[model samples]
Target: MKLSLKVNGKKIEKEVDDNTLLVSFIRENLNLTGTHVGCDTSQCGSCVVHVNGKSVKSCAMFAVDANGSEVTTIEGLEKDGKLHPVQESFKKHHGLQCGYCTPGMVMSSIDLLKSHKNPTEEEIRKGLEGNICRCTGYQNIVASVKGAIGKV
Candidate 1:
């Protein structure tokens, strides 16, 4: 199958198998390994990426499904060597531990902030309910999203 995807603001055209998952395509085809595959079942947010400005589990979607759609991975957040405010906030707030879930968390947080810039604590928690971080206790992860709004 042929797929044309807009990933991280770059146009990508590739030949892929019908069974190829979006996460596999991003990590292998595009070499954007920032999006992790913690669980192929789509339960973990580790495979989260923004598709057309909305958060979706890359593992749950097919590469062909994203044809011509804009995709944003962790690598897309940085520009001109400057990290996104959410990325910086995650660092400052200690939002990660083992770091397996950081990419998805940041991606999801970016989408969340887009919808609710001034999200309350409960809203942040609710927004992140899909993404699970086994390493960090999630206190700092919540703080990171909340802290990123003003800075971004």
Candidate 2:
């Protein structure tokens, strides 16, 4: 079926199979590989992307589900060659080690911070329960989110 998508602030019209996961469409079709597919299952947040400003696991959703919706990937966070505050905080706080989960973590952190405003350490931990990262042990990751709250 033909679907129109607003991705990274641009409009794209494409044809996709009904079973095509959003992850595949973004990485294979749109070539936005930053949204990794760590787990095809919904457990991993590696495929997280913003659907109209709310983070959603792309792997858990189909490309057609995003039809006519606004989607933002990790590549969209950087504008004019400048990193977003979350990205910068991740770098500054060493939030990533293997770096596989950084995109999803960053995306989720942005949304969490947006909703929480001033989140406690525990709140940050619980807020990111959906996203799992094997590296960095989440200490620096939480710090990155805390640091990016007002800065972003």
Candidate 3:
């Protein structure tokens, strides 16, 4: 199957297997490895990416399904020489420890802030329920989200 989509603001057209997962397309074809594959299963949010402005688990969707959609991976969050506010907040608040889940966390956080302009601590926690960070105990992660609420 042929897939065409806007990835990180760049139009990309490529041939892919019908069964190829979006995660595989992003990592193998696009060479954007920031979107990690921690677990092939959907239980892990490590493969989360924005598809047309909403976050979806890349591993759960076929690459062909993403054809014509606008996709944003972690690499897309950075602009020029500056990092996204969420990325900066993660660094300022020490949101990650092992860093395996940071990319997805940052992606999810951006989507969360988009929906909830001023989310409370509880709302932030509920919003990120889909993403899991084994390291950092989530304390700093939550703080990072809260700290970035105004900036994002």
Candidate 4:
């Protein structure tokens, strides 16, 4: 299959298997390893990425399905050598521990903030329900989201 898409603001065209998972294509074909594949079953949000400005679990979708779409991995969140505001907030608030889930958490949090400009703790919790963080217990994650309320 010929896969062509804009990844991290760069146009990309490559030949990949028709059944290649989006995560695999991103990490293997594109060498964007920031989108981790924690679980192939899609239960883990570690493979989350923004497809055409919406967060989607890359493991659940095929690369061919993403053809012609704009994909943003965790690597794309940084611009001009600076981290995204949500990423900066996460770092400032100590929202990560093992770091395995930070990419997904950050991506999902960005989407959450887009929908809820000023989300309450409960709303943030609900928004991040799809993403599981085993280390933080969500106290700091919520704080990070709160910290990035208006910065997104």
In model 1, which residue pairs have backbone atoms overlapping below 3 Å? Answer: none
Taking the tens digit of each residue's C-alpha lDDT, what string does model 1 give over 46-95?
A: 99999999999999999999998999999999999999999999999989
Q: What tens-digit string does per-residue lDDT give for candidate 3 at 1-152?
A: 98899999999999999989999999999999999998788886999999999999999999999999999999999888899999999999999999999999999999999999999999999988888888788999999999998787
lDDT tens digits, residue span 26-100, model 4: 999888999998877888798999999999999999999999999999999988999999999999999999999
Q: Candidate 2: deviation at residue 41, Å?
A: 1.0
What candidate 4 gets wrong by more than 4 Å, as runs, is none
Clash count, one per candidate: 0, 0, 0, 0
How well is each residue in 65-150 modelled by candidate 2, as lDDT tens digits? 99889999999999899999999999999999999999999999999988998999999999999999998899999999988987
In candidate 3, which residue pairs clash?
none
Instruction: Tell me the whole-model lDDT of each prediction, alpha carbons only.
Output: 0.92, 0.93, 0.94, 0.93
Candidate 1 or 4, higher lDDT?
4
C-alpha RMSD for every candidate? 0.9, 0.7, 0.7, 0.7
**Per-model TM values vs. the true structure:** 0.96, 0.98, 0.98, 0.98
